[model samples]
Target chain A: MSLFHPTGPRVGSLLSGSIRQAAMTVARRDHGTPSESDGAPASTVVEARTSGPSAAPSLGPSFRSSEVIRVEHLAVSYRRSDGAEVRAVEDVSFSVREGEFVTLIGPSGCGKTSLLRVMGGLLRPAAGQVYVNDVLVKGPMPDAIAYVFQDFALFPWRTARANVEIALQLKRVPRGERRRRALDALDMVGLAEVADRFPRELSGGMQQRLAVARALVSNCGILLLDEPFGALDEQTRLVLGVQLSQLLESAGRTIVFVTHSLQEAVFLSDRILVLSHQPCRIKKTVEVPLPRPRGPDQVKSPAGQRIEAELFQLLYRESLV
Target chain B: MRIRPASLAEAYVEVGPVRRAPWWSPAGGRARLRGALRGRRLRVFLLRWATVLALIGVYEAITRLFFAGSLFLPPASEIFTRGMGVFVEEGVPEALQTTAVEYGIAFAVATLIGLSCGAALGAIPGARGVGRDLLQVLMALPQIAIYPIIILFFGIGPGAKIVFGVTHGVFPIMLSTMSGVGEVEETLPRAIRAMGGGWVAVTWRAVLPSALPSVLTGLRVGAKTCLLGVLLAELLSSVNGTGALVMMYSANGRIPQLYALTLGICVGAFAVNTLMTVVERRLTRWRG
Candidate 1:
């Protein structure tokens, strides 16, 4: 079993009073988006109340809409220093519909990152075709999509707001509009106060959120995040995961994420693509039916546990091979 | 359970509404000003200058009370005055001007050549690896040893000094450019490219800007090395400039004049280093 289990003994004691209270609030409180369909005990959480927040219930069944991104028999390889081609990923096929968060999870060095990069048009597939918005992607499509790098690859020299403005600058957006929109995105991510602060001045989670703000400022339809919170600790990841679900709640953009954490895969993903060892291939696809707002409590619920277990086993077995 | 301590705060500090104190309010304005003025940076600045002045006082005392003649160890006050004397001294002013001109011309040439070469070397991998090895070898060789060959080829005019300065200064700037290019994390350029930003946009916007601080750093080192190189050439071959003046004074046992001339060169180098630092800090103000 992994550490930081919500129901486990250590989680409550390990977390300080405030975080425990926040976690308690998150696990117990429901924004009451969908009706009371949960099979879990009501005593565990306060009675669900119908609350109308700014973000109306996810706009349409964009999940049921046409495939926004698709890959068929996609293969990626790299030439060794000795000049021999070593395959990283092959024969992986998947489709993500509009406004759905699809996560790719696998064993270490399983080419999950390479597969994501290929879809982003960063790395060319050695064989087969990858499509974004039904167009075969040959290079980066920054206008249509934005990639959130694993390391929170923010420019060291730009302020949090300026970093968000980079893509808009490339788009040649008006200066007034760019500054206003950049601040709006930072405000959306709860980083409005740090809009003028440099990246180094902020904490790790703030930097990660700033990166997300940078991606969001352009308002691209598709966001391809390669473990945007990979460098962060488990607590930060949990909070960012919840924040991402809320972001999706409001924005309703198509997301393709690559991560190593099974809990993370199950927590935020509409569907999880589990890949095998090198020469990576999709072994299974698990669809999460836990509804729109999947919080820390939802992740610990029966539905979330079953899917997390399955994902863990798939990755664990692949790693053994 | 080997759980580490909570190295991270799980939540951010609660933020409150911003309230700006009225600028015209005497008590509020004075409080903020005092808080800012008595800050850590100001204290450090004062301490730094205090230490410098104290060291100067100790040196002054030692030279006046313990030292022998003016040729052996001139007083600090005399050195300062004599160092400034090169300005009004008849032929000394011309020689100083010549040295200043030579240094400026050499530095400019070095920067132009170094930047172009570094960008070219960094942009291509086949060249970067080979050039890196070549640079390592060149950096290992003593610059003094190359003086004979350079003077032979270009002669004892501005040509030899310029070439020498370029040779000394170019490597650091080039290496800095190469590393700066390296520092532009691949993700940024890729992100720009993916965002409809073309190659030219990527190079100009992301590549050059990100590498600037590092390139400036290389320039700082290059400037000092160029100064050293030109002066070295002036000393060995040229019959004019500060380097030649120092040699002429030393040969005639004009120790105070030699010391003054050397001090002038030091001050000039310090100015270059300080100016470059200010530029570097301005360009990289966002960095920690």
Candidate 2:
């Protein structure tokens, strides 16, 4: 029985069976390699499809790279306006391989954005540690990472090109290179024509692309996107999602995307981490086995539908809780 | 809901659709011009003016007909006819020049000092509370009652008027600037910081633009207050200007000249307000 098929037993049982299979597959892959059994290879091990009662689709070969990010026992809390302490995220652990695309998906207020913020060093976790390429994330390391906010947080006063140029200026990139790189990033996002236009002059979707341009032009190895396409209309969202997938494919940078939309996650991610409600815990990690260079045709494939249905089921169950 | 075409037709007749003509048509252009002229807002403004004119006419009639023997009440026409001549009198003109100089100097000094101090206080939380309380105290003080002391110190020249004006104008600007900078949204500063902006960048890019509209508002308030301060000083001890001219006409029982000078002061205030409004509009165009 396929774990993703709707005809399976309750989603929880399917999820448990898949997790067990993934664990066994990871154990076998680790046994083959001479690497130490410190759960490090498990972070990069791609789960294999097996003949079992809860067989999941096989993930492709792993992209070999050292861990770019390692988050361990992370917990975050905030004081409410009424002075009550509310824990947003608690004891969540995950790691991402270099050049990999990992996504975090859950219902609203599940603290996916909070976890991304912790990784980006924008918000300090109450407990546990986040390591970026072996160094602890004490503050925003502009050289190592860049963040794209959901609201297309471009400076309203600046033109699109200027917005992209800002990060380069901060890094003290040479004047000519700054201009070239900024233009190049805008070109990637198909916003070269609107480079001189202010944020107000462009549509909401265009503004988000400009934000992506800004992040990409920084040339940081790790990119954190916090629901970047959440504000767009449905049609615009789909178009931009494909464009983003292509952009990331070319850039080959590690991406950790946070979104509430399951379809978006299934469409863009190599691995989707479903999170439970607040004091959020990672409930399941599903590997997307569909081959990339993904397009509209790939989106309509049987494999895509299966993945989408599985993600939706996980999200629906999470919402009920 | 009744689908009654006849009733709908009757309703349309009672409140006809506004017929819009093509923009390039001669009659259309004329109609647009007339519509612009006869808009509801324009009608309201005209009605207000008509009321004022009628009141003035009644006052003129009462003075000219009912108070024939009285020298204190003069007809409005007589005041209008002689007002410009009195304004051009050598003593009056010199006094007016002195007041203008005093107003300019005081307004400029107060604006600079207030803006700098307020910006510093507002930007630094430690200074904001104490600075605001001190400013409140200054604002609460009776500025006019201190004229005698100002006269004793500055000795009734343009210096005294400038001092008085500064005292009156500085508080509003300071208060406004403090509130303006304080009211800047937190998100803007956070966004700047996320972009790797330091304190200087955040202040220049985010805080300053957000606070500008309020700063302009402060400037307008300061201008009006400075004008009031200048008038107060002149009324108390000035040797020349519109205030001095009013005093002189009143003492000599020149009712018509006094009335005319008062009307001139009203016009001057209106002109100042209109100029400030135009400047404010131009400078704050980026707000939209």
Candidate 3:
């Protein structure tokens, strides 16, 4: 049996009840009666702490493990101009183990971006659940999740460091700490030298790295990268892919990466999840058996070649469909 | 084909003899200077000036020779002489000062009103269509046609001039401001939101900066319109300013003075346009 029932009324009741109870407590606090003045409410506070909001839905002991994210039965769809609903992702399910690098490889328009958006809580799934540390995500949980977009969406007006600082700012981190963390993140991406330069001044690869730095600086447990290096040339992509692997390994963050390139998937992932075309479903999940601290030569190794070939065939078949 | 030494020499002489000078030598310096003069941007600038000068030359020649001593079509030289006197005249400074004040006030008021209305309308969802249509209708109604109505209300003073100027100036500014805010890139807003910005944050950071270049364009157009409005008011009813001076000279049959005042107004308009253009360029340099 599932530890946290997927469609449990208990979880729903817990969410609503906690919100109501929080509101009531806020009202009582506003009215200025100290908890000690009301002994009954003081006992209620102890109950609220032990059996209240945090206890409502059992996020499962799996969440307590190093693993930071768990997703189940996620579906995303958009209504077309003609009023037809185009389901982008349907019944997609996956989980990221703590400090593991996993990538979703699929053809273009196969809902890779939609999947990442769902992971980041930017889009609410039609009929599924995404749990970050046992809590169901309803909106952007910026404190726990950061996203690196495919297009290297850095603010043109801000310097590379400022772009990273912006994410920290949203989290309400103190100024001195924000800058120091931002600088450290930039240093990890090897963009510390160009910290003062604006996005326009950087090359495509550099800009992508700066975006990675921005995501890293947020100190989120889970990072969702939607084809972060898709726009770069091959040589730059390969170099940056290795750099990213090193950075994430050092940070010990769970990453759910999406990419169109099979080689990139094989190069960076602990496991490669192959997704089908529109209304994308998980076709297969192939565990990448390649050794860690993977380099370019490993990608050329016999095992890497076999994995790439398998992913290619799966992607090619999906495309034909 | 082989050529005899004499024939080669003759050909060289005919074609302009090739100088045995280094690339940066005096001979090469002439060629470089010529090339610089013929560069595309320099050529275009020179062509504009040349056309304006040619038109003035044609007007000066026609008025001097064909007008047959008629004061109405005074020659350019006569206008220049009278223009110098008009500049030195006792009340001319005060008239210029009054026109400057009126133009400045009109431009400032029009810009503020235009930007506020334009931004509010442009940024609102589904309202741009109605706003644009209304603006188009307003723009179609000429400010000149309402001069009598405005004079009735403000009674032919600086107030009327300012009101007239503002009426003329506001539309272009509004339209430009709307266009500027409308053209903010689609990805910019999405990017900001993805980074966890709320509506106000997106507007202040992404939308405003992206719309700045367009705003500058509107301000330039508004500046020109303000100049036009001020002139129209002065010509129609004002007691002072370059426009009133022109009207006084015309009524008095002082054709030379009238032409000089007209020239002065044109120069003033040109100067204001040039200043605004410079400001626009400086402000929008980052857009490229």
TM values, all candidates: 0.81, 0.72, 0.76
lDDT per residue as tens, model 2, A82-102: 999999998998888765689
Model 3 lDDT on a 0 to 1 scale:
0.74
TM-score of 3: 0.76
Superior candidate under DockQ, 2 versus 3: 3
Which pairs, if any, clash in model 3? none
- Candidate 1 residue-wise lDDT, B110-208, digit = tens: 899889888988888678878878887887789999899998999888888888888888888888887777657787787777667889988987899
Give per-model CA RMSD.
8.4, 12.4, 17.1
Q: Judged by DockQ cut-offs, is candidate 1 incorrect, acceptable, medium or high? A: acceptable
TM-score for chain A in each prediction: 0.80, 0.79, 0.79
- For model 1 chain B, give the 10-residue run with minimal summed lDDT: B1-10
Report clash pairs, candidate 2. B95-B240, B95-B241
lDDT of 1 by residue, A1-321 (tens): 011222324334323223334334334323321221232322222111111111223324563246788788999999989999999998988777666678898887889889988988888999988888889999888867888988887877788898889879999999998888787677667677667777877778788888888887776778999988899987777666766765554455678999999888887877788888988999988777665445667688897899888888887888888
What DockQ does each prediction reach against the true complex? 0.30, 0.07, 0.07
Check candidate 1 and list the clashing pairs: A140-B194, A142-B194, A142-B195
TM-score of 1: 0.81
Model 1 Cα displacement at B253 (Å)? 3.7
Q: Provide the lDDT at A58 for model 3.
A: 35
B198-244, model 3: which lDDT tens digit per residue?
88878887888778778888888888888898899999888888789
Instruction: Report, for every candidate in turn, its global Cα lDDT versus the true structure.
Output: 0.75, 0.75, 0.74
